[model samples]
Target: MKIGYGHMGTLTMVVELLLEELGHEPVVPHRPTRQTLALGAKYAPEFACIPFKIVLGTYLECLERGADTLLSGGGYGPCRAGMYGEVHGRILRDLGYNPQVIFLFPPLIKPYHFFKKVSLLKGRCSWFHLARAIRKAWTKLTFLDQMELLSQTKRPRELTRGATSKAFERGLTYLHQAKSLNEIIEAGHAALAELDQVPVDPAADPLKVGIIGEIYVQLEPFANHYIEETLGHLGVEVRRSIYLTSYTRHDVLSTKGDMSSRSLAMPYLNQKIGGHGQNSVGDVIRYAKLGYNGVVQLAPFSCIPEIVAKSLMPYLSKKYGIPVLTLFIDEQTGPTGIQTRLEAFVDLMEQRRAQTREGARMQTGSAV
Candidate 1:
């Protein structure tokens, strides 16, 4: 089946792997652009989150590609993601696209009680094949995610530009070409090997920035304009609080790790915050304790959870003594605006750095 899907951050890569195994060709939708957002907005529910709009655009593009089906997770719970698939499906049907919808995340008829509503791909593939595919893709996805998180702490600046990306591209290339599980295994090793050697400046002062906000906007480069790279280009230390692997693992497993640890479980947010709520608060606090100078909270225009975070962030800033910047994105969001705000934030952090050192020296002299 020829299908299309949206970017739930790096999960796209893993899903791509699974689709290939299922012999279902993935017609990757165009990266989020002004056009993509516009098409999505046109058919999307006004109250639905922006990610829904973007996903609609993806399906619309796939229809243009003559795809026979669309695959995406059904957003559930108090969060908008749970119901997005059905909403988008109706929108596509109205647009005259009759493609089958493969809603990956079944509708949760009852909270903490899954309803098993995979109506589309219900009988398409063997259960064994589907489970195996998920296992393989998830295995690679978890390792890649953890490695990336570690890279952020161990060498944030260098990996930012093209190092981590180069490794990822090379790995994906190999993953695409693999015909056997052993081949996938070999490609993973090579990918990590390439990733392990990214460059970094040992003397660079850690001017940490916490990434928080909508999951889609937090991870998608096309939607967020390669935000991590923008921070790295300015020579500011980047502290990542999100990764696809961790998010996926959190979804399946318990977040029982330490809140005090720098890279501990995302404990601050066990209960879903109706969308990026707890993550926003946790990132701000996490960055503060990790000695970060700034936090960047991303949100699409009209996202409720992030909007909630934006409202309460003033307290987080006052409590932590760290500055926070909110970037509300939409079709009109350009790389220029993002860069401009990020530059100013980093500049302020630099001043904070200067003041901190001056205070340290003053204390020493007073002691003398």
Candidate 2:
């Protein structure tokens, strides 16, 4: 079957690879655009979050492009994301489209159901083939995450403006077109080498910023108005608290780390609170402890969990002595406004750093 899914940064490309490996035609649409956002907002529920609207538009575009099936991730808890697949299916059916909709839930929740769904999508591929395909996809996903983090680190230090971004884009293209394990490895190595070639200032001390927020807004550039790229251009190093691989490890693979988000957040939030609200709190505390200059929280407008996280920002900021900026995004959010806020935030971070250095110098002089 011809399958379609939403545009989520490098994730769409990974899903495309997976579908192709399973012998199905993948109808991936272009990255989320203004037109796509408009179409989705026009059809989605009035109060539905931005991600739902954007994905709905993506699905419509895919269906128009001849996709017979739609695939989406499922959620659990107080987050509304768990209902997205069913709602999207209903909307499509009401609009007279009858494409099959599949929701891939976490395997640990319902192993039999998850495997059954996977078997359906695997089509004629044997179990071993499916395993190989998944391995290749996972490898590509991990590489993409590393590539992004590298770009963020390099962007602020590159001697030439936009040099790191240009190299990063080239690397993404190389990985996107790669079809084999060897090719994937080659693309990764070549990409990393190209990034390493970008001339960087050894003495440049860029402001360090950690981004904590809802997964969709954090990962999807269009949704967050390309906040990471904007920050990078402003000479700030950005670190995201979430990535697909990280999510897979924590949620899908159930790999427990020494410091889980829940444990970190328990002192403050003490409950799941749906979505990444709890994680946001935990991640902010972690960022502060790691000595980041500041933190930015990106949440879809009206997102409850993020709202809760935002509400706690002042407390976190005051106690941790780190600045926090909360941005609520929606269809009405403009790039200009976001740019202005980011510029101001960068300045604030710089001022804080300068004052910190002055204080340390004064203390040393007094001791002497």
Candidate 3:
């Protein structure tokens, strides 16, 4: 049986690796693009968010390519994400496609249920083989995350406009082709070392920006119009607040990292309001204290969690004296407009940095 899954940033790579290792043909559609967005948007309801539309388009492409089974991750909470698998499946059926849907819920909440669902895909692989596949898939995921972080650090400093990005793509290519844990580690190191060779502007002091919001919009460059690359091109350093590794550890393995998000957000947002809303607030507070120059919250239009978090941004900005720019996106979002806003934001950050340094000098003189 052929299996297909929608894109969730690097999660696609993980799913693809797992399916191949189990002796199943993984029918991954081409990466999400404008055409993918248009396809999904064509059939999707007007009110449905961009991610829904994108995933719908993805399944359609996969179905057309001969995939009979669909794999999707499930969520719980007030967030609409929990219903995507069911809703998307119905939409596909109504459109005349009869693909099988397998929605994998969070493993932590219901380990038995989660594994039972996963076991359905065991195909001809033995339990030992399945275990090995899981381990290899996880290794690839973590290595990819690390490579991405390294790219972010190098992007702003690269002397050539697209050098770091080009190297990053090459790194992903290497990782994607690796078949074993040792090979994955070697590929990661080789890729990082290649990035290290990209010429850099040692004197450049780029503005630092932390990205926080719904995981899809934050990680999927196509959805957010490649915001990270744009920021890097503008000589601004970018860091995402969430990555697949951290999410897996905290949510899947039940190993908490920096549980401080709850404590940090308590004053502004006291409870889990579904999705990553609380994390958004907490990330802003944490980044501000860590000396980041600014923060960008990228959320899809009509996203409840982010909308709720956006409401508290003004208060957080005032209290922390940090600038926050929230971009609400959908199929209608244009690259030109996003570029203009990013350029303006970067300029504002530069001005703020200058003013800060000047104030520091003035205070020093006063002390003398």
Candidate 4:
């Protein structure tokens, strides 16, 4: 089987590796581009989240390239993502393309069904081989996430514009081409080293911002207009609340630690509202406690779960004393508009931080 999946940041690379190891040919779609978004938006339901449209477009591209199978993640909640596979398949069939669509749900929720689906793809590969392949992919995923975290910290302080981004991309390329576990480890170390070498101003005290919202928008640069890079260019240190590794650990593996997002969110949201709504609320509170300057919520227009989270933003901001900016994204969301809003938000954070420092100083002086 020739398998195809959507471009989801570095996660795509991991999927590609897994498919190859499973003895299937992987049809890697190009990263989401303007044309890709247009194609997806054209066929997808007008009200569907932008991620659905984009992934649909990705599948269309894969089909055009002769892919026979489409793989996607499924949700088990009120989120619209649970219906994506069915909807995507129907749309493709209507358009006269017949491909096998597979949706991987959380294994913890339906282990038997999940393994049954996995068996279909494993084919001639032994169970041991499959396990090894997954281990390798997981390792690569961890390293890829580490590189991203390093880039987020370094990008804001780098003296040369785009230097950290370039190094980060180079590291991604190296890791993607790596054929062995040793190579993967080497690539990860090399990538971090290169990022560390980028010249940065020691005196630069960049504004720290936490990103929270729908996973798709948080992870996909195209979906969010490359907000992380944009924020870094504006000299803001950005940290995302989700990554594939962490999501898998907490959501798929069901191994929530004592300070899990669900636990942290109990004060604001008592239960899961579907998608990452609860996590968004929890992570924002977490960031505030960590002294982040602000938090940005990215959600697709009409995303129900995110909308729930957005409704509580004002309350969260006021109680936490942290500024919150929510950006609703769609195919029509333009970079210029996002950039302007980001600049204003950053300025607001900066002013707020300065005032906080002055207040602290005045209080200390009065006591003295």
Best by lDDT: 2
Lowest lDDT 10-residue stretch of candidate 1? 256-265
Model 3 alpha-carbon miss at residue 283, Å: 0.8
> Which pairs of residues clash in candidate 2, taking residues 3 or more apart in a chain or in different chains?
none
lDDT of 4 at 294: 95
- For model 2, what is the error of residue 292's alpha carbon versus the real structure, in angstroms, after optimal superposition? 0.2
Once fitted onto the true fold, the runs of candidate 4 whose alpha carbons sit more than 4 angstroms away are: 255-259
For TM-score, candidate 1 versus 2, the one ahead is 2
Q: CA shift at 239, candidate 1, in angstroms?
A: 3.5
**Greater-lDDT candidate between 3 and 4:** 4
What local lDDT score does residue 45 receive in model 3, on the 0 to 100 scale? 89
Residue 332 in candidate 3, Cα distance off native in Å: 0.4
lDDT of 4: 0.90
Stronger candidate by TM-score (1 vs 3): 3
Q: In model 3, which regions exceed 4 Å deviation?
A: 255-258
TM-scores for every predicted model = 0.84, 0.98, 0.97, 0.98
In the range 5-69, model 3's lDDT, one tens digit per residue, is 88877778788889999988999767898889999999998999899999899899999999999
Whole-model Cα lDDT of every candidate shown, in order:
0.70, 0.91, 0.88, 0.90
> How far does residue 251 in candidate 3 sit from its true spot (Å)?
2.6
Clashes of each: 4, 0, 0, 0
Candidate ranking under lDDT, highest first, comes to 2, 4, 3, 1
Worst 10 residues of 2 by lDDT: 251-260
